[model samples]
Target: MQAVAIMKQARISPQKARLVADQVRDLPVGRALEILRFSNKKAAQLIKNVLESAIANAEHNEGADIDE
Candidate 1:
């Protein structure tokens, strides 16, 4: 799964973005969602959106379903 964090009209440094993105990389769907949900960082929301998209893609393309 891929998690993308986008900064728009914000003064976030690229290094910080990369660091946050790295934290979410290769994490399982559930844990990643939890991290994004409770995180106070703005980047976390962007990452969460990307992660949700990835999860949806996995469900549609890979036939992997996340247990709700």
Candidate 2:
């Protein structure tokens, strides 16, 4: 199952957000969070929040194990 969370009208421009997203594409969640935590760009923080929310949705709504 897949859980997706999207943030619209972000303070950051689309171009900048896309750049951050591209960097984490195909990366594992743990690694992606690490990269976002250390990233110099502000967009990283926003993306990280959305990612966390998606994870929560997957766990709570989809009843998926975090270890998976």
Candidate 3:
């Protein structure tokens, strides 16, 4: 699930939030995090957190390591 933190940080309208979330959704964790990291938007930090969570979930639940 996308984190609510994205909304809080970006101060973005609901439509924009949905668009941003949709853009990143289903993206590989590392690539998603990189996209967020270089972003100028405030929502980037929140997006990074969500991506990190997704990465952690994938690592623990699926025995996949994003570092590799």
Candidate 4:
């Protein structure tokens, strides 16, 4: 199953958020969270929150395993 979460009209610009998003693309969820956790950019926290919500949706709603 697949689920999506979106955040609109964020205080940060798209370009800035995209920079952080790009870093996590094609990475495993665990690795992505690790990178975001220690990231220096302000956008990292925002992206991390959104990513965590997405992961929760996938796990609780879709019954997907984190290691999947």
Predicted structure with the largest lDDT when compared to the true one: 2
Query: What's model 1's overall lDDT?
Result: 0.71
Summed over model 4, clashes come to 0
Model 2: lowest-lDDT 10 consecutive positions: 1-10
Q: 1-68 in candidate 3: lDDT tens per residue?
A: 33222124455566755665676778766677777788776556666776677667767777775666
In model 1, the runs with Cα more than 4 Å from the true position are 1-13
lDDT of 1 at 46: 73
For 1-68, candidate 4 gives per-residue lDDT tens digits of 45577777678988999999999988888899999999999899999989898988898888889787
For all predictions, the C-alpha RMSD in Å is: 3.8, 1.0, 4.6, 1.4
For candidate 4, the 10 contiguous residues with the lowest summed lDDT are: 1-10
Q: How far does residue 59 in candidate 3 sit from its true spot (Å)?
A: 0.8
Give per-model TM-scores.
Answer: 0.67, 0.92, 0.58, 0.87
**Which scores better on lDDT, 1 or 4?**
4
Write model 2 residue lDDT over 1-68, tens digit each, in one string. Answer: 57889898789889999999999978888899999999989999999999999899999998988777
Clashes of each: 0, 0, 0, 0
List per-prediction Cα lDDT, in the order shown: 0.71, 0.91, 0.63, 0.88
Better of 1 and 3 by lDDT: 1
| Model 3 stretches with alpha carbons more than 4 Å out | 1-13
User: Of 1 and 3, which scores higher on TM-score?
Assistant: 1
lDDT of 2 at 38: 99
